[model samples]
Target: MLTNGLVVDLQQKNMKIALIGYGKMGRAIEDIATKVGHQVVLTIDDPDFDAETLKKADVAIEFTTPQSAVSNIKKCADAGIPIVVGTTAWYNDYNDACDYVLSKNSGLFTATNFSIGVNLFWRITEMAAKLINDYDEYDAFIDEVHHTQKLDAPSGTAITTAEKVLANFGRKNNWVHHENGIGSSTNELELSVRSFREENVPGTHTVSFKSDIDTIEITHTAHSRKGFASGALRAAEFMTGKSGIYTMKDLLNE
Candidate 1:
């Protein structure tokens, strides 16, 4: 299942999947899922889709917008279907959503980004953050690029990276996302996460620690959506016969 503590293709079962959002990410997941001999029993493209059909699926993969992620999670929970969520910007309600699923005796697996490289990138970034934290001479910030059509500004990957950074950065207690202007609640302890939108860019995230002497940067760039799609399906497979909340760390056996 893991190659030197990193995730790789290690499938043991073919599952009936319920695709909760038939958008780009959903289509991507379905294409790979079908090629791997998995069946897609149901798809929800509209808000009015039948929730009863969820019971037909062994696992549900949700890639909907932030506004719709919570309700979709609840429906899967009600159906007693294990769900893997790839949506971002809905984390404020994440605890409630996971609690509801757990109460229903269903499993929940969620990730901000499903690419294998991104998961590894977080670890590399953490190592850098921890080493840099011992000295206050360098300051760090995150820079991310995504497609223009992406709903969230700072990309969920950037936020996750910042969380890893904050865990060790002695001076930074929180992160600030820079949109048209600086996000509210600016403070000295806040690290900056700058976002850029371009055409046809899958995604790219860089963490830079800069000082007056030199700058250190680490980056992971995605060429396409295939990596995310494959990882999400593998996560679905991992959810089979499992209960409780899971993340990429758990899936990769980290």
Candidate 2:
């Protein structure tokens, strides 16, 4: 059923959602949310964003910069609202945030990349890295492209992808960001990641293993923002009545 530009889920009814960012991802979430039978009750983007509006939501989906994500999530948890956070680069404080959520008895779900395809790509990258772990002949690199307006270079998706590969590929000890060319260490095991920004491109991530004889690459290109928006809404639904901190892997496993 549909009502006033809202998608009404026949089985689960409607959920009140609070949007913490009004950027491209935030707008995408709003569109997808209404189409999936949920209502966006609050949107906070400005410097004077009202925290009280968050109380109107049963669950909140937050996508903001690392500088603000932790504090925004803390507010939502303090309000006793469950939240799904898609922000990245804030994992440095993730443990503290989780503790706060537990103390407040609020539910929290977070992802470096919330697009379902990207999550699957993480797993695939791990499997491929493990397969080539013993093959010292090949060197690995990560390259990603995004819109010019993106605030972060290399992106959170690229970082997560690099982390997965490093964890599985025994040869690689660490990753270094490189621009215009690969890193200098030909013999040492290192992963070089590069980022490119273009006009209006949603996202594209590539993992490549190269050797003198051959090359293997895996790429996941996001044609639109809808995939990410959909996943966040799904996370909000999953977290509606739950408690404790969780991750995208946990959500996917369940």
TM-score of each: 0.92, 0.91
Deviation from native of the Cα of residue 22 in model 2, angstroms: 1.2
Q: Name the weakest run of 10 consecutive residues (lDDT summed) in model 1.
A: 1-10
Q: After superposition, how far is residue 97 of candidate 2 from its true place, in Å?
A: 1.2
Against the true structure, whose lDDT is highest? 1
Report lDDT (CA) for all predictions: 0.88, 0.84
Cα error, residue 118 of model 1, in Å, equals 0.5
Q: Give the TM-score of candidate 1.
A: 0.92
Q: In model 2, where do residues sit more than 4 Å from their true spots?
A: 1-12, 179-187
lDDT, candidate 2, 1-254, per-residue tens: 43433334323458898999889999988887776678898888865566677888999899988889889888888888999999887888999999999999999999878777898888899999999888989888899998888887778899999999999988888888775344555646777888888898899999999999999999999888877877788788888888898888787883
lDDT of 1 by residue, 1-254 (tens): 54433334547467999999999999999887886678998988997776688998999999999999999988888888889999999999999998899899989999999988899999999999999988788988888988889999888899999999999788899898887334543576889998888899999999989899999999999888888988999899999777789999898899
